[model samples]
Target chain A: MALFTEAFLTALLAGAISAGIPLLLVGLGEQMSEKSGVLNIGIEGMMLAGAYTGFLIAWKTESMGLGFLAGAGGGMFVALFMAVLCVRLGLNQIVIGISLTLGAEGATAILHYFQFSRTYPRLPATLKWDIPFLHDIPVVGPALFGREPIVYFALFLVSVFAYLYRRTHFGLALQAAGDKPAALDSSGVDVLKVRAVAVLTTGALAGLGGAFMAIVGAGIFVPFMTHGNGFIGIVLAMLARGRPLWVLGGATLFGACLSLTTALQVAGIDIPTDVIQMLPFAAVMVVLIVLGSKANLPVSLGTAYARGER
Target chain B: MTSEMAIAPDSGENERKSRLNMRDDRLHFLIITIGPVLATLVIASFILMAMGVSPLDYYGYIFQRGMLSPSGVQATLTRMGPLLLIAASLIVCFRAGIWNLGGDAQFILGAVFVAAAGPELVAILPVWLMLLLCLSIGAAAGAVWSLVPAFLRAYQGINEIITTMMMTFLGGSLANVLVKLVFLDPETTVPQTRTLAVSDRLPRLFDTTVSSGVLLGLAAVLIVHFTMNRTAFGLRLRIVGANAKAAVHAGLPVATLTVIVFSLSAGLAGLAGAVAVLGQTGNVRADWNPAYTLTIVPLVFLARFNGFATIAFVFLFSVLSIGSESAARRLGVPNYFTLVTMATLLILMAVAEMIDQRRRKRKEV
Candidate 1:
């Protein structure tokens, strides 16, 4: 009985770590973007685009690290396009973001089709980190220490981001840009540059999240496989209320919810599987409801700043 | 004073002559009617030519193979039916300046609800009555589904775009659940709802393949267009949409209008679902790919807010979709190239608008 219980706990922990990494990366990345007053709702599409690009690059070059960089670069491309629309053109941010999501989705699918036109190539498999001596441990090693280095990197990023946002000059400028771009502008910070860099970096990190899943988790690129994780990141960002530290908590909670849903299905509970699958979304809804009740968006969030206007 | 009055009358005469001259400009009127079609043709031809095919032949083949043939027209009309209905619904909300990105979710919920409700209602009522009940049920479900984001936007001030979009994805999952758990068809190879009863289906329009659903969609469009363009409520919505603060200053009920417009838009989207189940698919199936909600947005926007233009755009898109599939099979081209083409066209259109706005600014300067 103890053996079975330990095995179950090990699987649950493994699932949480695996699932949480992507959310953590995406949420933290999006938090940085939003903190600079740009909402990249296209993150999901960008993730999918990155997944394909990473998979294709890895498939061709047979290099895992190159694939990861390609993924981040692919995401950056889309983010730069969004910056052009939102910052340069002064389009409605939400519409432009959504439109770019649609555009990216269509473009990514086309890219996938063209890449696999001559031959079917599988995603580059992720390498597991076999920690010295830790690999000898029974369940804990496999559950915690056996993940790819990328997973550790993602978790570390969460804390690093939390620290940066909490205590850094650049982070302060980003926050100032989001809440009061005018103040930042007056302070001689190029608000547009700050916002642009923030959005671009968000894309790169989100792309990394996609590469983690496509290369490591599933080892294949599937259409719409990010499966609303990008939106979930948005919800996470909202729940965090732009606090990087809170984002860690929010992402872990979401990841736990996702892991629980999977575990429940495996446990063969009497509850409907769809109802369980819906838990993450339900959690997000609850967060949004609370966030909405609290009215917590930065006062100037989701708006493009026009210079010399009032 | 008498000489100045004489000159004023002459000036008025010149103004009237200029107005009459504008009406006489037939060439300008022709451009307005023929410009979009020409643009579409030119783009389509250029694309076909670039692919090393004769554009004229391809156009002819499409017309002869799809539209001129009975099945072609029937298919076109069949596709047109739901599209027109959905586009009209989209138009209503857009006109009110509310972006309901939740159309897809509303659509899926409507399908799920009708799928669940159709068979039971058929046993209780006659065929036509059952269809009506299913549609009403579907519309109600959509409205209920849409209320979440709409209410959030109105009361809590959440951004409707994300909330609506999130709801759409959730609704899709809910549809999957319905198919997998509630109405899982045991006989099908894939997860899908049970086939609805034949009696519950919409009547065929002709002895041909076309269904009465096409007429119904057209009727809905006409009714909605009238409601939007010719009604006081619609005018109030337009005012509210254009400037909410100004609308309030003008004593228009902006809040009430928002709720009404969103509900109506969602209800219309639900009707689209009902039509799909009753007229086209004859059952709710999870096998349906692509998010219909996202699909409808481009269709509506690409219409540039004209109801008449929406009808044409839907027809054009349906043809492109079917034609692209045929091209994939016959020409060995990637079928999704159609979506790529459509996306490119959309981005181009937006760019064109941006350029136009800039030119206007330059002229003003």
Candidate 2:
């Protein structure tokens, strides 16, 4: 009711960003993958893998940084496996992606069962960073300035990706490969090599996002911890029309919806919690419906490459 | 001087000659039957070993407990009720080249509808009539839930895989909240529905835990198999699945077929849920995490979308599940070991297919 209360709005925005960070990382990664012509539907599985690996490593080693790296590494390895199937084996990409997602989920569950017997301790790993100058700049600054390191990392990556995608040759080539692989091939670039790297990079970022969820957000590894974060990322990437910078906007909106639902529940809304929980997914569905109608994606985004076509 | 140019046998001639005799008996067996049975055994063994139990002892114990004893047989049948039905439901869609991963949700919706309707219907109707209503409502609920992804794919072009999966999540959470808030039995320590009257429950077969659902599931399998192989609609479904563009060119209503097949598949899942409620659980509960929905993928994969293969795969998975529990109790191993085996076998099956594809490529070259 108190819209003018700077403190109340600040706290709300802060919490929204906290929730948004995971989606932001995932969205950025998926954007890169989609831009390069691979729809990494296995993003959720990769996130789950990251969550398990991050939790297991952090709990065992008591090193947050190492756990994060382990998560990224785990995601990269799985993404590379997917790359092998899609890029080298020429299986149906959609089926391969779905299979990879299932595989990651199955593998994570199995490995975690064997490694820790699903009994690892929850270790608090995320560090809260407070900027000296920014923290002193009144209500807004204090609210946003003091948060987890991941928030900053997510924001930084958004800027980096926006630049790389719009201004760099590598970005142009990657985008071109998605829209017209033949052109990229004719230009003497190895499309497979570029796409493989793009897919791996996407996995690493998604893994990092998932690691942030486990090590920072939850402080423990619960089963299915990723909880469709990767899918939300896909929705965000799609909603953004595969534009890297726009992914941040999409992630923020989705994140806000999630945070608002949770907040509304806490605020004792009369609606069922199930209804509230469906808001993010509903939002994504709506966004996809709108964006899919308007946006024209790359023609060859989901198609397989023929040998030496150029 | 040493020899004239030697004439080589024409490969094209060999191809033409082999065309009529193109039956690869071994490959056919691998595809149709052996693959599923082998995958099941491999997964079952992994699960047993991981539980620190010897597979031999576990299998022996399962056979003794689950197959030999009357009570054990009832237990196995009870477990098979939902799984068989779910697998059968999957067969209908998968054979038509559509994958329905929302079975978990559909199943829960059926349960929810049964819980919501059972008491009200009991006041006005006979037990059999009430049961029929519950089953039909359940199927309707499932069909409604399925319409989202079906419509999206049919018209808007959203990926059904993700959409269907998202619905599963939504359905699960919705079921949980309903169980917690609406149908909860206040006296019970955990959230669940009030137990229904015995007359309203599914009829037990010869005073055992096994209900009539097993027969119903088998009937479903037969019906679905016949529909796919013998019917005009089934033919269109197969063509559309194989190539939508070609099917459209051939004057088939691809969109209508897509929606109908999806609805049929989801309705089957819903029926599975009703069976679980009336026949197995005898009441609804929040423990709606039916792992079979996800596990069904591997089962269907092993079966290659064949109805009989689906039954065989389900039976195989059931044995493994039951055997794993026996191993855990006897050998002090964890039950999740079974899942590990199932996953490993699934990956292996995919890899095997990939290898087969490569072999074909080499043969062509």
Which sections of candidate 2 miss by over 4 Å?
Answer: A2-11, A34-41, A91-120, A137-140, A167-169, A172-191, A261-272, A286-310, B1-28, B31-74, B94-100, B185-189, B206-208, B360-365
Local accuracy of candidate 2 as per-residue lDDT tens digits, A1-310: 7343565556556657767788888888888888888878778878888888877887888888888889888788878877887766654455556666766775676566666775856787467889888987776686578877767877999889888988999999889878888888888898888888888998899898888888887798776778778877876786677676778877777677666654554554556656666776776666556655534456566655666643
Tell me which residue pairs clash in candidate 1.
none
True-vs-predicted CA distance for residue A133, candidate 2, Å: 3.6
Per-residue accuracy of model 2 over B234-327 as CA lDDT, tens digit each: 7667776666677789998878888998899999899888888888776787755664676776566555566776776677667667766776
Candidate 1's residue-wise lDDT over A1-310, tens digit each?
A: 4434655666767887777777877888888888888877778877877777777787778888898899999888888877887777755465456666766776666566555654555664577888888867877888888878887778778778877887889989999988889999999999888888898998898888887778877787765678778877876786677777777777777676667755655555456656656776666666677767653666566677778766
lDDT for model 1, on a 0 to 1 scale? 0.73
* Model 2 chain A: lowest-lDDT 10 consecutive positions: A2-11
lDDT of 2 at B242: 63
lDDT of 1 at B61: 64
The TM-score values for the models, in the order shown, are 0.84, 0.84
Clash number by candidate, in order: 0, 0
DockQ of each: 0.20, 0.27
Supply candidate 1's per-residue lDDT for A80.
86
